[model samples]
Target: MASDTASLRPMPAPERALARKRRYRRRLRSRIILSFVIFGFVLTALIASTAVYLRNRVEDQVISAALTKNNNVFAEGFYRNPDAIGVPFEKIQGRQFSTSKLDRVPDAWRALANGVHELTEQDPVTGNERVYRLAVRKDPDYWFFLAYDIAEERESQERLNRALIGSVGIFTLLSALIGWWSAARVMSPVSELARRLQASGDSTQPEPLAPHFPEDEVGQLASALDDYAARLTEVVQRDREFNADVSHELRTPLAVVKGAVELLLSRPDLDEKTRARLLRIQRAEQQCTDLISALLLLSRNERGHGATDVQRVAEQLLDAHRTQLGGKPLALRLEGSRELVVDAPESAVNVALGNLIGNAVKYTTQGEVIVRLLDGAVEVIDSGPGLSAEDAARLFERGYRGTHAEHSLGGGIGLSIVRRLCALYGWRVRVVPGEERGVVATLTFSAGNGTL
Candidate 1:
C-alpha cells in the first residue's frame, strides 16, 4: 500500500537539487562579499593565534632561565650563611630540605625534575588558585625548590587575547565593507549590459552592446550576445516571411474550392447522398481555412479580436465530427448554455475548441462525446479511455503523444497549439480524468475574454 502511494506521488528529479539549492543559494554579489569576509576572518584568526603562541613561548623561556639563575644564587647564599632571613627576589619563595627528610616536601611537588614546572595550587585562606613557575635543584647535601608567581603574566595573556579578538572583528567588518564596494564596482558593467540587452529585446532592432563596454570579459559576453541576436533576428524574419507566403499562396486554392462548393450546394436537383458528400467537403475546406488562419496567428504570435459564438462553433464542430463517425455507434453532443460568446476570432475559437472536440472524437470508439458549455468556458468530455498521470502532465508538450495515440493520425502538436492559442488570448486550458471514465478537456476564458 505504501509503495503504491509512493509510486503515485510526484518525485521529479529536480526536487532534490532544488531543496539543497535553496539552503546554499546566494546572489553573485553576496557570494563575493561572503568570500572576502571568510578570508579576512581566517587570516586574522591565524595571525592572532600565532602571536599568542609565540608570546607564551618566549615568556616561558625567559621565566625558566631567570628562575634557574636566581635559584642557584639563593642556594649559594643559604649554604654560605647556613640560614637566610627571607629570599633573594620579591616574588620568589625558596625551600631547603635535607636529603634525609625527603618526605617533608608536599606530595604535589615531590616528583619534580631539575627544571622549571608550572603548577596551580589553591590558597587555603582565599580558596583561589595561584599559578606558579617552580624551579627545582637537587644536590648531594641538600635539595632546593624555588617558586615564582606568574598570575600577572596570565592576566596579561588574557588582556592580549581580548585585544586580538577585537582586532579580528574590526578587520572582518572592514573586509565586508571593502567586499561590498568591490562587488558593486565589478557588477556595474554587467548590470548595465543586462539592462541594455533587455531593452533591445523589446525593440524591433537592437543597439550594439559591445560598443558601450570596454574590451574585457563583459565586452566579450556582449559581443557574443550581439552575434546570437543577429542570427536569431534573421531566422525569425525568414520564418515570418515563409508563413506569410504560405498563407498568401494557399488562400487562392482554398478560395476557389469555397466558391465551387457554394455553387454546387445551390443545385436543387442533387441527390441526398451526393449533397451530404458535398457538405462534408465544404466542412473539410472550412476546417482547412480555419487551421491556416490559426497557424498564421500562432506564427505571428498575435491575437485576432472578434465576438465568436461558442455554441455555434461547438455545434458546427460536432456536426463535422458526426459525419466522420462512419459506421461507429457513437454520438456527438453539445449541452448547457447557448448564450456563451468569446471575444476572439472565430477561426481561433474554431481551432482551439475544435482540437479538443477532435481528440475526443478520435479516441472515443463507441461512446458519446459531450461538449458542455459553461458561463465563460467549454468542456469536451469523452467516454473513452481515461487519461493517465503521465499523459495529463505532458499532454500540452509539443511532439508528445499519449499511450492511446499509437494508431492516431497526428503529429502530437494539436494540444500544444491549443495551449499556445490560450496563452496568446489570455485563456486557460487543461485536461483531466473524468469522474468515472474517459477524459474531460476544459477551455476556460479569462474574465475579460467573454460574456455569458
Candidate 2:
C-alpha cells in the first residue's frame, strides 16, 4: 500500500518551490543586476569611509600642532619670568608646574608623555562630558601642558558623517538604476534571439537568426543556433524517411508471411504439430507488424487515436506468452473488468501490454502471471522474485537491466519503450514489490484517455 501511494503522488510543494528559486537565480539578467548593485554599494562605502578617516586625521594634526606651539611659548615665558601669568586663550588652557610644585599638576595630566593625547573629562561648569586634546612637554625643571577643547570639531565631524552616509545611499540608488538599465540593454538582443528561436521551433522550417543581429557575442550565438537547427532538421528528416521506408518495406514481407500461414492453416488433415507451428507463425507475424507500427509512431513522436479494448489486448498478450512457455510449469490468467477501453492505437497498446506480460512470463519460472484489468488501469502481477530497490529506481532507463535479467536474452530497452509510450499517451506505469513475494506492474490511463 505504501509503494502504491508513493508511486501516484505528485511532486511536493517545497521541492517545486526550490526548483523555481534555482531557475530564478540562474537567469543572466538577474545575475548582472545583482553584480551592479553590489559593486555600487561596495565602492560607495569604501569612499565614504576614506573620507571620514582623512577628515579626522587632518583635524587632529591641526589641533595638535596649534597646542604644541602654544605650550612651548608659555613654558619659555614662564622660565624667563617665574611670576608670568598663564598663556591666554578662550578654548585653550596652558599650565606649568615647577619641580618643587609638581604635585599641583592634575593626576590625569601628570602621567602623560610628550605627545598629543585625547582625554574625556567632566565639565566643571556644565556637569557634562567634555572632549579635549592634551599636549604635554616634560623637563627636569618644569612640566608644561596644553589642553584644547574639541566639542565644536566633534559636532562638525558628526554632521559630515551623516552627510557621507546619505551620499552613500543616494549613490547606491543611482547604481541600481544604472545596473537595471545596463542589464536591459545587454539582454535585449539575447531575449529577441530566444523569442525568434522559440517561434521557429513551432514551425516546420525555422527562420534564420543570424541575419537579424550584428556580428557580436549574441549574433554569434544566434548563428550557432541556426547551424544546430539546420543539422537537427536534416537528421529529423532522414529519421522520418527511414521510419517510413522501413514500415513500407517490412509490411510487404510480413503480409506475405501472414497470407502463407493463413493459407496453410485453412487446409484440413494436417497434423497437430504442423497446425500448431502454423498458428505460432501467424501470431509471430502479427506481433512483428504491431511492433513495426508502434515503432513508427514512436519515431514520429505522434499518438494515433483509437478505441483499444484493454481487456482484449491483455488476453492476446497472455495467450502469446503462454504458447512460448514450452515445458515450464506456469499459468497465465486474466481477471477484472472486460469493458475498459483506452483512446490509443491498438499497436501501442499491444506493445505496452506485450512488454509487461513478457517480463512477467520471462521471470516467473513455475508460478502464475495474472493480468488484472481495472476501470482505467491494468496490472501485470507475477509470482516471481520481487523487484529490488535498485531495479525499481532505474528500470525504465534505456539499456538498464534488472538483477533478475542477468541471464535474459534482451538489450533491456523493452521497459524503456513502454515508458515512452505511456508518456506519449498520457498514461502512467510503475512497478513495485507485491504483497508477499512477486512484482506488480501497473499501467494507468488518465481520464479522457481511457474510459469504461
Candidate 3:
C-alpha cells in the first residue's frame, strides 16, 4: 500500500534521477545504505558531543554565577566558615589550579575565579563527609582558597543535555527523509529501462528509451540496447522478405503440378501397360505438387505469423494419401489426441507429414507404415530397407541419399522438405532404424506448439 502511494505521487526530478541511479547502480543501494550508517554514526557522535559540551558549559555557567559563604551546618560539629562548611577542592595531580592561601574562601569566590568544583558526600581530600566546592580565587600575584556547595550547576547541565538530545533527534529524522527521497529519485529511470527490455522480448526489435544519464553507464547501456534492437529488426525483416519471395515463386509451379496430375488421372488410356505407366506419371506429378506445397508451407512457417488449423490439415493430407496409396498391400496407422494442435500453418504440417509418408510408401515394398503422433511428434515407420547409420546421420539434409534407397525418386528432397518445414516451425527431426527391418523418420513439433 505504501509502495503504491509512493509510486502514484508526482515524482520530482531528483526522486526520479535517484531512482535511475539506483537501478543502474544496484551498488548504489548498498552505498546509500552504508552512507546512512556512516551518517548515523557521525550524527550520533556529533549529537553526543554537543550534549556533553552543553552539559559541561551550562554547569560551568551555573557554578560561576553562584554565591558561596561559610560551611556552618554539620550536625557532627563541623564549624561553618565563610561557607556552610569549609571544604577544599581536589586538584588533579600535575594540573595547574588554585593554591590555598586565603583560608575558607567561599563557593562564590570559586565561581568568580572561573574554577569548577564537585559537591560530594565524602570529602575529596580527607574522605570525611562534606558538601564542598573548594576552589581558589587567583589574582595576578596569588591564589585564594574557596569552599562552598551549590546545586544549580548540576540542574542546569541536565537541562542542557535534554535540549541537545532533542536537537539530535530532529536532525536524524530530517537526514533520513532526505536520504530516502534521493534514493527514490535515482531508481525511476532504471525501472523504465527494465520495462522496455522486458517488452523487447515480444517484439522483433525494440529501441531503448532515452536515458537521463546518457553520458554515464546507464547511457551506454541504452545506446547498446538500441543498437541490438536495430540489428534484430534488420534480421527479422530480411527473413520475412525471404519467406515472402519463396511463397510467391512456389505457388505457380505447384498449381501447374496439380493441373498436370488431374489431367493425367482423368485420361482414358488405350492399354493396361500404358494406363499403368500413366498412373506412375500421375503419381510422380502429385509428388511434385506435394513438394511445391511443402515448400510454400515452409515459407509460411518461417514467417511465423498465422493461426493454423494443423489437425484439420494433417487429417486432410492423410485422407488424400490414403486414397493415393489405395490397393497397395500396405496399412497406415495414424494416432493423435482429439486436439492435435500445432503452431504453424496447416500447410506446414501437411507438407512435412506428406513428405515423410510419401517417402515411406516409395521405399516400403511391403508391411505397415505407422504414423504415430504422441505429444507433438509425427513419426513415420516404414518396412523399407532401414537407413544406414551413415545415411541416417545426414538424412534430413537437402539432396542427401541413403545407401539402400540411392535410386529413390524426387531428388531425395522428401526428408529435406521435412527438414526445412521443421526449421520454419522450429521442430526437431530424428531418423533412426525402425523396430523391424525398416526405417523410421520423425518430425517432432515440441517447440512449435506455442510458436503460433
Candidate 4:
C-alpha cells in the first residue's frame, strides 16, 4: 500500500529558479482566461453581424418587388375602365398577387387633396404600409392612377425576417457558448500543468504532470517546459557541489591566517620593528577576511533577497554607519516620513556603501561626508577633489582608473564593485560635483517609499 501511494504522488525536479515559482499562478490563470475570452468575443460579434445583414436583405427584397408588381396592375385597371372609379373598391386590384393576400388590395384613396399621393399606397384594413415616389404623371381623362397593394409585401417580409432572426440568434448564442467551452478546455489543463511544474525544483521527487494533456500548442509548450525542468535539476545539483567546494577552499585559508597571526602576537620577545611588521600582516589578513565574508553574504542575499519591505533595511545600514563615524550624529531626511525600500538584496547596498564611504574618508581632508537616504536613493557627499563629468560617467567601471583616483590611495576597483552590485539589484548610480569642490555619489533605488 505504501509503495503504491508513493508512486502515485508526483516527483519534484532538482532545481527551479526562485522567481519563476513566485509568479507562476497569477501568470497562468491570466493566460488561460484571456485566450478563451478573446476568441469567444470575436466569433460572437462576427456571427451576429452576419445574421443581421441576412435578415435585412430578405425583408427588403420581398417588400420592394411586391410594390412594383402591384403598381403595374393598378395602372392597367385604371386605364381600361374609367367608369369604374365609383366601383374602385367593388373589384379590388391585384388581390391574387405574390406578396401579401391580406385586406382588399391596392386602391387610390384620396387624402384631403393638399399633397399628391405617391405611386405606393397603404391599406386602411390591415395597417400594412408601402412607400414609393411617383414614377410618372397621371392621365386625368382615363382616370388612370398607378398605385400598388403594399400590405401583403410588408407582411411577407416580416414573416421571413422573424424566421431568419429566430434561427440566427439561436445559432449565434449556442455557437458562442460552445466555442468558449472548447477554448477553455484547450487552455485549462495546460495552465494547470505549468502551475504544477513551477514547484518542481531540486527535490528528489519530480512533479508529475497529468498524463492526458491536450494535443495543441499548449501541450507542446508544457512538454518542452518539462524537459527544461529536468535539465535544470541537474544544473542545480552541480551548483550545490561547486558551492561546497568554494566554501571549503575559501574559509579554510582565512581561518589559518587568523590562527597564525594570533600565534605571532602570543610571542613575548618581539621588538618594535617585528611588532610593526606583524601588524601590517594582520591588516592584509583582515582584508582577505572581509572579501570572503562579503562574497558569502552576497551569494545568500541574491538567493533570498528581502521582501518588498525596504525601509527597515536602509535604517539598519544607516545605524551601522552612525556607530562607525563616532559621535557625529547622522540626521535622517527622506522626502517623507519613511525610508525608501526597493526590491534588492542587503549585500547590494553594503557593497555600494563600502566603496563610497571608504573612498570619501581616503580623499576628503576636511568635513564629514553626509550620507542621505530618500525615496529611491542613498547618497554620499564628501568635501574632496570634485570629479569632471567625463571622469564621473565612467568611474564605476572595473579597471577604469580615474584622474581623481590617481591622486588618492585608489585602484578604481571600489566603485566597480558598487556598479555591479547595483545592477544585480536593479538600482542605478550617478556621481556629480558637490556644493563645494567635492564629489557626491548617489544611488537611486528602483522604487520609492514615502517621498514627494
Candidate 5:
C-alpha cells in the first residue's frame, strides 16, 4: 500500500561543531604555512644561485690572471734557453709546447684556440687525477703552452657547493618554524573572535566584541558584527510584538465563531443539513486556531512539544474535507495505524499534515485521498494525476504552481509552509510519484528527543 520510505539521522551538536572548527583551522594553517614555505624556497634558490655565479666568476678571473702571469714567466724562461725547455719547470711538473699541435697532451686538450682551458688528467708518477689550467700563447717563432695545477681550487668549489646546499636545508626548516609561529600569532585573535561568535548564539543579548581586539581588520569585523546584532535584535523585537498582536486579534474572532456554532447546534429545530453545516463551521474555526498557533510558532522560530495522536488529527482533517466536498466523487479516508502518537504540539501536526491533506483533496477530482499513519511518519496519498518532473522538482518552492494548477484557486504556498514546518521540527517531508497513478506526500518525523 506504500511506494517507499526513508529515514534521517541527526548528528550530535558538539561533535558537529568540533568537526567544523577543525576543518576551518586546518585550512587556515595550511595556507599560511604553504605561503611562507614557497617564499623561503624562492629566496633561498635566488641567494644560492647568485652566490654560485659570483664564486665561479671570481675563481675564473683569478685563475685567468694567474695563468697569464705564469705564462709570461715561462715564455721568458723559454726564450732564454729554447733547447733546454725542461729546466725551467724543475720544481713543478710543468709541460712546454713549441708548436700549435699538442701531440703529447691528452686528446681532450688537443683543440686549444690560444686561451686558458682547464682539463683533468691522471698523473703517471702519482697515479692520481690532477686538474690543470692550460694557457696557450702564440709567439713569433713558436707556440708556448703552460699547465697550472688547480686541484685545490676544484676541492674548494665542491666544498662551497655542499655548504650552500646544507644552508638551504637549514634555512628551509627555520622558515617552516617561523611560519608556524607567525600563523599562530595571526590566527589567535581570529580564533578568539570565532569562539565569541559561537558563544553569543546561546545568549539573548550579545556583549560587545570590539573592546577585546586591537584596531585592525579583526576589530573592524567585530564592530560590524555589533551593528548587525543590534539590527537583528530590533527586527526580532518587532516580530514578537506583531505575532502577539496577531494571535490576540485572530483567536478572538475564531472563538466567537466556535461559540456561535455551538449555540446553533444546540437547537432542536435545526435540520440535518443545517446541523452538518454548523459542525463544518466549528471544524473550520478549530483549524484556523491551530493554523494561527502553528504560524506564530514558525515566525518565532521556536518549538513546543506535547503528546499528539497522528491518527486522530488525520481523521479530523478527512472529516472536515468530506463536509466541503460538495458533489465531487472524491473519498477522503484515514487508514493504517490507529494509535500512532508523536511528541509534537497538535497545532504543528495539524498545520503540516493539514496542508498535505488539503492539497490532496483539492487536486484529486474523482479518486480517493488516503491519510496513512506509520510508526513515525504520515503519508497523504492522492489518486490525482501523478506529478510531472517539473512539479516534483519545484513542488515545495514558495509561490510555485504545478502543471495542474492552471485554474486552481491557490497561491501555491501550502507545500512551502509544510516544508518550513518540517525543517523547524527536525522532520522530513518529501513528495514522489506513487507506484500506480498518484503522488504520495510523506512526512517522516525525527525519532530524537521530541518523538515518541
Candidate 6:
C-alpha cells in the first residue's frame, strides 16, 4: 500500500509556479529579440537592394552618355582628318578603328549588335585589368569602333557595395543591442510585480502595486492585480468570520449534546436500547466536530500538522461504522503495521480515511472491510462487488455516483473531498480492483518532513 520514493517527493506548488513563470519570461524575451533582428535584417536588405539598383542605373546612364559624346566627337574628327584619329579626352587612353574588315575589332565586340557595350580587357603595357565601353558605327565602306575606359567607375561601384554590406552588418548589430535593452526595460516592471506577489504570499495584507508604475500596460496589469487581491482579501475575511461564527454556534450545542449523552449513559436504570442510542449520538457529535474542524482548515487553505497515528484514526473510523452496521453480518478489521505515524491533524486524517472506509461499508452487504496501514499509505479493501469500468473511471469526479451507488444515499462528494485533501497535502489517492473480489482504495502520504 505504500507509495514509491519518487511519488513521495513532489515539488512544492510555489516552486513549480515560479519555474513556469521563468520559462514564460525567457520565451517572451527570445520572441522580442527575434522579431527585432528579423525586422532589422529585412529592412537593411530592402534599403541595400534599392541602393544597388540606383547605383547600377546611374553608372549605366553616365557610361552611355559618355560613350555617345565620344562617338560623336570621333566621327566629326574622322570626317575632318580621314587619316589621323585622336583620343577625345585624357581618360580615353585606348582608341581603335577598323575600316576594312570586322576582324580588326576585338573578338568580344564582334558578336555585339549596335548600342554601347561594356567589356573588361587586360592592358598590354601595364598588365592591369581595365573596363571599357564600346560604341560601333558602320559607314558605306568602313566600320568605326570607339572604346572608353571605365576602370575608375567599376572601382567606385565595388567600394559602394563594400560600404553597403558593412553598414548592413553594423546596423543589424545595433538593432539587436537596442532590442535587448528594450526587452529588459519592458520586462523590469513585470519582474518587480512578480517579486512583490511572491513576497506577499505569506502576508495577510498585500501592498499596493499600481502606485509603483506609470499608466501603461504594466500599470494596468498591476492595478488589476491589486483589485483582485483586495477582493480576494475581502472574501477570505468573510470566510474566516463565517467559519468562526459557525464554530462558535455549532460547537456549543455539540458540547451540550455530548454532556447530555454522558449524563444519560451514567443512569443505571436506562434500557440497553436507549443507552446504545446515546452512545451513537455521542460518536456522531465527535465525528461532526472533527468534520467541522477539517472543513474549516480546508476553507482556509492551510495544513494542520500534529503527531497523528494512522492505526488509531482507522480504528476509530471502523468502530464508528460498526456502530451503524445495524445487525449486518459484516466484519470491520484493522491490519498491517500499527506503528505507522504521520504529521497531520487527526481531523485531516479522519476526513480522508473515513471517506474510504465509509464508502466501503456503505456499498458492501455482508463482507469484511480491512484497513491496512503500510510504510506511508493506508488501504481500505472491501469485499463488495468490484467496480465497473464506468464507475472506476469517474469514481472520484464530483457529483458522480457509481452504478452500485444509484440506490445509495449520498451526493457522491466524499471521494472528491478526499482528492482535494490529497492535492493540498501533496499526497496521492487511488482506487483499484482487489485481488479476488471487491475494490481497494489507497491513500498514500508524501515522505516529507511529516512522514514516519
Quantify all predictions' global Cα lDDT against the true fold.
Answer: 0.86, 0.86, 0.60, 0.55, 0.82, 0.82
Model 5 residue runs over 4 Å out of place are: 1-23, 83-93, 100-102, 122-129, 138-141
User: Which parts of model 4 have CA positions greater than 4 angstroms off?
Assistant: 1-143, 149-176, 202-219, 267-274, 300-353, 362-381, 385-452
Q: Model 3, 1-452: lDDT tens per residue?
A: 01110001124456786887666566764566457656965787686887697767775665444422221112112222323333333321111122453444444344454354555676569876654454443544344444444445456567767776776776666666666676667655666777777667666556465554456666787788778778877886887788667766766776686677577667776577665666666656555555555665554444444565555655655665666675778776676654556766555566777777778877777788877766566667888877666675667667777676756566777677666655555577776676657777766665524333
Q: Give the TM-score of candidate 4.
A: 0.55
Question: Per-candidate TM vs. native?
Answer: 0.89, 0.91, 0.41, 0.55, 0.88, 0.83
**Model 4: residue 171 alpha-carbon error in angstroms:** 6.4
Return model 1's CA RMSD, one decimal.
4.8
Question: Going through the candidates in order, what is the number of backbone clashes in each?
Answer: 0, 0, 31, 8, 0, 0
Query: Which candidate wins on TM-score?
Result: 2
> On a 0 to 100 scale, what is the lDDT of residue 353 in model 4?
63
Q: Give candidate 1's TM-score.
A: 0.89
- Model 4: weakest 10-residue lDDT segment is 1-10
List model 1 lDDT by residue over 53-120, tens digit each. Answer: 99999999999999998888888988898757458588889898888999998887788889899999
TM-score of 2: 0.91
Return the lDDT, model 5, position 423.
68
Candidate 2 structure quality by residue, lDDT tens digits, 32-84: 88888899999999999999999888887888888888888888888898798
Which pairs clash (backbone N, Cα, C closer than 3 Å) in model 2?
none
RMSD of each: 4.8, 3.3, 14.0, 12.9, 3.5, 4.2
lDDT computed for candidate 5? 0.82
Higher-scoring candidate on TM-score, 2 or 4:
2
lDDT of 5 by residue, 1-452 (tens): 33333222345578899899889878998789878888887899789989999999998998778777777777787788766554344223445654554566556655776789888888889999988888877665566667777788789989989999888888888888889999999899999999998888788788888888989999999999989998998898899999989999999988899899999999999999999989988888988899899889888888888999888888888878888899999988888865667788999999999998998888898889988878788899999987887787788889999888779898998888887787678888888888988889888887874468
